[model samples]
Each structure stands twice: as structure tokens, then as C-alpha cells.
Target: MDALGIAVIVAVLVVATTIGLWHRRTDGMIRDEAADKKRRAAILAAAGVETVEFPDRKSSNAVASAAAKAASGAAAAAVHGNDTVRAANAAARSAAAGVPAAPDLPADSGIAVPVDSGVPAPAGPVDEAASAEPAGADPQLAEPGVPGVREPGDVAAERKSGVVPDSREEPGVVEAAARDASAAGESLDQGLLDRLGIGPAQATLLQFSSAFCAPCRAVRRISGEVAELLPGVQHVEVDAESHLAEVRELNIWRTPTLLILDAGGQVVKRATGVPSKPQLIAALGDVLPDA
Candidate 1:
């Protein structure tokens, strides 16, 4: 072959090789993202935060974190932090308004679990060490407090005319304060929370499903009935297909998983497969109490 022709062929080969590598990298990225989401879901579920609507928390926290960093002068325009932050804020607003898609997870370098054709429970019982009942005592204040629950009537009389409970002012103290606040603004989110069916007060019957969960209507009905059987409990349904976040948040790899929490928002029980009403009721009453 002529020298120029040989050179041209070599250049074409190099370009093709580069394109192939890029395609492979892109595919790997996609796979990794999916795996991370699954892992994240499992992690969240394990933490007993199943009903908090992760996408909202994630978006809200991202915005708050960004604002804090910017306020501290840690963001860089050259790094496009401003643009990214702006985009996240806009996305957050859209997500709140149901006007946009949920944000995607950043691609990761770790592998996720095996192919889940069926909703499989974890291999064994809750890891004894992690699930240990804090030496016969439940952890103190692990569950989030339920509003309109045991509220002191004087809480309303002490309210200001227009002041909202600022998570600032006291700053970084709201989580604990928000959990224990007896003030007016601090206790009103219960209706919103009750609608979501999550609180430490009792089992809200988030869901009762099974593996290969497709048509989740039946599962919802069954779960609802069981939840009703228990007073002060709210039942909510999340189909495995539609709300993977809830599954991941509550480590619900198995359908028919039950998440039992105390009023402090801590996960005290995780039951996979169908559990009887008595079994579930007993779990609701179970806690470490002082751990």
C-alpha cells in the first residue's frame, strides 16, 4: 500500500478503537449507576427510613448543603458548582411540584447485588450484632415523633403570631429539636407525615408485598387491612416496580417485608415474607427502650 494510504488506514483504526472504548465505558457507567441505586435502596431500607421519600430528602439536602458551602465560599465557578447548584435547585423545585423526573445517582465504582428476578430476603436473620437490642434496651429517641400525639395543650397558647421554627437560629439543632419540639410550627407536619404513613409511634403498614411483585393492588389491600387491625397505625402502599426508593430505603429486597419503627424513627424490626397480625403487633411493641 502507498505510504499515505497506510497512514490513513492506521488513523481510521485508531479512531475506531477509541470509539469502541468510549462505548464500553458508557455502558459500564450505566450499569454501575443502576447497581448503586439498588445498593442505596437497600441501605436506606436497612436504616428504617422507608417512608421519608428519599428523592425529596436528597434534593432538599443537596440544596441546603450547596447553599451552606457557597455561603462559606467553598464553591468554585470554574468547577461549575454554581451551575450545578442552580440546576439542582430548579430540579428540586420541579420535583416538589411533580414537574420533572427524579434526579439520578452519580455513577459509582462498586458492584451491586445479583440479578433480582424475585424479591429475595436477605440470606439470614438480621445480623445479630447490628440488630442486637442494645443489651435489653431500645435506643432512646430512635423514631421521629408524631405530631398531634401527646401534645401539651399549652403548646398552642405559647405560639408567636408569625414566627416559623427556624432550623437556623439554633441551627444544626432542628433534627433533635424537630423531633421533640412542643412549639406550634414544629408539630404541624404530622398531617403531611401521616399521609406518608411514617412515624415512630407505630407501624403504619408501609406495604405488604411478595417477590415478583407485579400487580400490587392485592398486596395493598392485604397490607391495608392488617394496618387497620392495629390502632394508631397508618398503612401506605408502594409497589415494587414504581417506588424502588421505598424498597431501597427500607432494605426491602423481599416482598412481604415489614418495617417496624419506634416513635423516634429508628428501625426496630424487619420481617421478610408474610407475618401474622400477632407477630407484627408484637414487633410494634418491641424496642430497646433506652439504647
Candidate 2:
């Protein structure tokens, strides 16, 4: 072969090798990116959040509509269940009061007495000795289904049907249940604050943020501004990713979650989104000293 032909053949071979290497590198980069995304999704899932792809417009609208309908149906079912329970309780009370099952009284307001078929009234006037004796009374005539008296079976039935019977113990049960509900609904107590290493302040704002969350930045800014405006108000920001244990303990499921703590470090208010300045100020006022 000629010299020029040999040089051209070598150039061709080099170009082919370069192209193959570039293709392999591109494929590896694509694989690595996919693996990284999968890892991130897995981490989010472990933290009680599922990563979702952006849906098309139509699918998004349909999903929103379905969610709204589901919510409405759930609310309606709750209302219906409450109403049914109330009606059952009212019926049970009415039955216990002898309001509906009581027999009609005599029109003349006279005592009702049952006469024996074969017995007749004495025609002659009663003697002094016989008149002095008291007349015999029938047990049934003395009481006509005494009001507010319930049988054991009836009480059990009412209870099984979700009607709380009127008894001395009922008030205590209701009070205890209310106390439990109040306690459950309340925010972190002093002991929990101490365990979390949160110090005492007049008002404290805790912000939970994730690394890739844009709204978290806005929340941080707002909380900082509020803290600067109010004296003795401290703002604490926590990385939701790094502090997984604390996030789980606080039940923080989303980024930019704000918890407003009172003087005793008890949570007074909480918000999930970027709250307005006025709203935050008002919430701080409620927990701040001398507000």
C-alpha cells in the first residue's frame, strides 16, 4: 500500500476507537444517574414519603377530582354515623324514661283498679271494725313501669348499640375519655422538649426542611423575620434528612413544617406550608410573654 493510504487507514481506526469509548462512557453515565435517582427515591420512601412522577395534565386533574370526592364521601359517612348514634341514644333515653311505653291514664284522674270476674261490691255498710282494717293492695297497681328504671338486658342492649347508659359511672368514663383525648391532641410536653434538647424560650419556632425543597427557603426567611420582630422568640431549623429520628419523633411528614412552642416548650401551634407573616405573628403573640 502507498504511504498516504496507510496514514488514512490509521486515522480511520483511531476515530472508530474514540467513538466506541465515548458511547460506553455515555451509557455508564446514564446508568449511574438512574441508580442515584433510585437510591434517592428509596430513601424518601423509607422516610414515609413516596416519590411520584409528574403526571400529565389530564391525569392530574382526574386524580384531584377523585381525591376530592373521596374526602367528601368520608366526611358524609362520618356525619351519618354520628347522627345515627345520636338517634339511638335519644331512643334509649326515651325508653328508660317510660315516655313512649307507658299506658294511657284514666281521663278522670282516678286510681285504676282491676275487678275480679266473680267478685261483687258489698251492699251493706262496713262495720267499725272492718272499716278500721286497711285494704289489700295489688303490687301491679302500685307502680306503673316506674320512670327512669332500666332492666339489665335493656342497658346492655343500649350499650351494645353504642348508647352510653345514664349511670353514676358514666360521667367518670366520659371525663376520663375527654382527658385522654385532650392529652393525645396536645403537642410535645416539657419532658419531650427536654429529651429533644430544646431549651426554654418565650416562644420557639421549629422549622423542618429538606435539602431539595424550594418552599423551605421561603419558610426559613419568614420564620427568621418573625423571630427578629419578636423578643425572646427563637427560630430553630432542622434538616429533615439528617435528623430522621427527630423528624419521626415529631411526626414531621413534610418539609417546611413549622412548630410554634410556648414558654414551657410545649407546642402551641403548627403549620405545614409557608405561612403568612401576619398569621405567624398572631400565633407568636399567643405564645409570647406579655402578648
Candidate 3:
């Protein structure tokens, strides 16, 4: 062929190659971005705070239909003397009613069932204090040594001065009263955790983070490492945006807010910024066993 024709053909080949390379590079970048997003989603799920997408009407209807079918099957089997099916039916009904289901005791289980009452007898000792408390009176507010309430020291001084004190006020008791107040607070915290579906751990380090916060990533790493080093310690990272209610309840006004919970799920300590590894370990020491 002619020299000019050969040169023109060569230029066309170079242009085509350049366009193909650019297209492939763009495709690779898109794939990489998608993969990174999926990896982050998996990490958040592992941290016990998953990003949930709102289901469309079709998907919601399908899920509801499936649940209804399962419930129907369980109810049908329950009529056939199947204990498991009976338990499932009860649980489904309770879930529909938005209440906790009663525990399903096996027929041969040694636990005694009260006659004339379909419920089992109480397994533990009754709380005398709860029984004695007057109706509509908050046990927590009634307790001494609590803020805005009568302090134990004041009660003692009043008793020594021959002033008649309230029956709930335990005069001459300070340390025990303080301990009781602390215990009451711990009990309330534990109950809150239970309602949130958080099980007991030796220590739970809850890190609240935002999507655009860079320091939050560092705190997550540090908290995860600390949890691994300490047995029975759990590390949970919550997305502050997704859990705004929890953020407001816990008074979290910043990203990378760390809440260190004791075994009883009580907030033992809290830090706002990124805490160093050593500082975190020191805080954990207070809640760790034998510390």
C-alpha cells in the first residue's frame, strides 16, 4: 500500500487502542467501587449495626405473605400434639400482639406447672421490697442517696435530732444506701440493654460513628483490637445516623463516641474523641475481671 495510507491506518489503530484502554479502566474503577461498598456493608453487619434498605411495596407484601403462611402451618401442626409447633404458634401470636411469648416448657420437664393456671410457678424468690412499695410510687425516686431525694446522711442527722423520718428512709445507713442506689441504676441500665437485644458481655465497647468522620475509623480499629485482647469483651460499632434515637438517648453529640459498658451493661465510662490504645485498656481495666 502507499506510505500515506499505511500511516493513516497506523493512527487509526493507536486511537482505537487508547479508547479501549480507557473504557476498561473506567469499568475496573466502577467494579472496585462496588466491591468496596459491599466490603463496608459486611463490616458494618459484623459490627452488629447493619444498614437496612427500605423494602418496596411488592417485597413487603411477599414477606408478609410468607410470614402468614408459616404462622398458618405452625398453627395447623399445633393441633396435632407437636410441642415445637405449639411453641412456634405461641411465639408467632405473641409477635403479632407485640408482646413477649411465654416460655414453652416441655411436658416432661421437671418444672412444676400450677394447677388451674396455665402458667408455671415462679422459679425465684419474690422481691419483698417491690411488694412493699406503694402503688404508683417509683422505687427509684423513693430511694435515698439519689439526687433531688433525701441523702442518707441527712436522714441520719434527722434521726439523731429526734425528728420523725419517712419509713422509706433508712437512718444510720450511708454506704449501704449508696450501694443500693448504684445497684438500682445498674438494674435500669441492664433492663434497657436487654430491651435493645444486647446480651451480657464482660465489657461492651459501643463506638458511635458517622459516615464522613475520619477519626471514627481509627477508634473502631482501636476498640476492636482492645476487644480481641480482652476475653468476654464485645466491640459494637453503631452508625449514628441510622441510630439517631439511641444517639439522642445516650446524649451522643459527636462522632467516635465510645461507651464502655460493664458486664451488667451499665455505662462504666465514656469518651468522646479517639482514645489511645493504652487509655482504652486502662478504662477497660476498671470493668474487667479482678481489676
Candidate 4:
């Protein structure tokens, strides 16, 4: 039609469309907020920290009736000096049944609520140390020198079962243990070689040692260091636990002995006592001529 008439119609249509969309958005937002509030109310009721009353799980219409009761009870408690009649009744039932009160919620002082079953107080006060810890702080949480306890998950029950029966492992026991482990099977033959993951295809440098024997450490340290530098060499540290068995079998007498074997698993060079770094390199050089 006319230009002014067209402009007026378009303006009216735009205003109507904007109003409709605005109302729709407002309604959606209101609905979303109500749903969120209901969800939060439900969560609070589940946690038992809500000001409103909700029936316990066993009750019929527990969730709905409980939510309504909780909202109403909260309003009532604010007006009625926090009567908490329902809470008191629940607590009373808990006490009579020898159940604990209020889940032992800790206060800001870090002390737990003392368990009571409506019973008389103990003849004496509870010991401060006897308080149960929150799982992780138990001293038995870790075994000494052991990185992770055996039961990887749920260590609580393990703390009770694997509780070190008052017999303490020695200090630096791991280091000493490692040393003793090295001395173990001092005269390891071919079978022990296979057990140690040393095969015919692998070159071997066996370090024989004895526990409580001095100078063996220095020898082991030097040979071990030199063996580390030699790429193809596999250092097998054997302990001299007893001379009567494998040592007698292997006809070995000296301690901190080094036996260099070629890739074919044949013994090529022998050093009695801890070999010097040069001696270690020379022994390996015989097995690995190029090195």
C-alpha cells in the first residue's frame, strides 16, 4: 500500500515477534530455575542437611513427601525456635537401637563426635590416641622400604591383617637387603644364569660377593660401574650366603669374584676380589675384544 502504512505494519510485527520471543525465553528460564532448585533440594535432603523434612528411604512416597515436609519444616523451624522434633525422634530411635548419632561428623577442632547409644558414660574418658584415623594416616599404611603395599586397592583391612607383628625391619635394611641379594647364589651355574635372565645370547659379567665382608662393596661398586659402561655386559651379582652348596659345586673359594663370560655364555676371564676399573675393563675386553 502506502509507504508510511507499510513502515507502521512492519514496526508492529517486529514488536509482537520480540514480545513473543521474550516471553518464551522468560518462561523457559523460570522452568529451568525451578528444576535446578528442585534438584538441589533433593540433594540436600539426601545428605540430611536440609532444613526441610523428608522421609527416610524405606517410607512410601519418600522423595516427594520428604521434599514437601522438608520445605514446610524449615519454614516452621525458623518460626518455632528450631523445635526439631523429628530429628530428636530419629536420634532417640538410633540411641535405643544401639546405633550411632549423626554419622560422627567432625567439628572444626578435628575431634570426632563420641559414639553414644543412650548408654551410660565409660568409667574413664576415652584415650586421645585411641581415636580412629581417616584410613590414610595409619602408620601401617606403608611397609618400610617397600614402595607400594601389596594390596593396591583398599588398604584399610590390609592394615589389620598385614600389620607387622611388632617385629620391626632393620634400618637401611633395603640397602643391606640389596647387598645380600647380590651375594645370593654366589656360585650360580648355568641354571641360575637362566633364572637371572642371562642366556647364551647375552654376554655376562658375574659379581660374586659376601655379606659382612668388607672391600667387596668397593670392588662391586667399581666393577658394577665399569660393567654399566660396557653395553653388552649383563652384571649378575651373586651372594656368598653359604660355601657348602653351590660354591662347592662351582669350586669357588674367593669373595667379590668377577667372572666375565662371552656372548656364547662361556667364562672368558676371572678376577678374584673386587677388580679395579682397569682390570674390569680388561676382563670385559677379553670377552668383547673390540671394547
Which candidate order results from sorting by lDDT in descending order? 3, 2, 4, 1
The better candidate by TM-score, 2 or 3, is 3
Better of 1 and 3 by lDDT: 3
Tens digits of per-residue lDDT for model 3, 50-99: 67532212222222222222222222222222232223433334344432
TM-score-better candidate, 1 vs 3 = 3
- For candidate 2, what's the RMSD? 28.3
Query: Taking the tens digit of each residue's C-alpha lDDT, what string does model 1 give over 1-291?
Result: 599999999999999999988755542111111123335556887998773422223233233322222211111111111222332233234334442221221111000100111122343422232122221111111112111211233223213211222323333312222222111111113333444456544334556464575434454554567667766666655455555655554455656555444333333345554555555555544321222
Runs in model 3 lying further than 4 Å from the true structure: 1-197
Candidate 2 residue-wise lDDT, 1-291, digit = tens: 699999999999999999978755542111111123345556897999965533212222222222222222222222222222222233234335442332321111111111101122243422221122111111111111222222344334433443221222333212121111101112354445555567756667888899988988888998899899989888888778987877886667878788876543334466776787887887666455343
Residue ranges of candidate 4 with Cα displaced over 4 Å: 1-189, 195-202, 242-244, 289-291
Instruction: Give the better candidate number (2 or 4) by lDDT.
Output: 2
Q: Per-residue error at 151 for model 4, in Å?
A: 67
Kindly report which residue stretches of model 1 are placed more than 4 angstroms away from their true locations once superposed: 1-132, 135-201, 208-222, 287-291
CA lDDT of every candidate: 0.35, 0.44, 0.45, 0.38
Q: Residues 143-171, candidate 4, lDDT per residue (tens digit)?
A: 01111112223234433343211112322
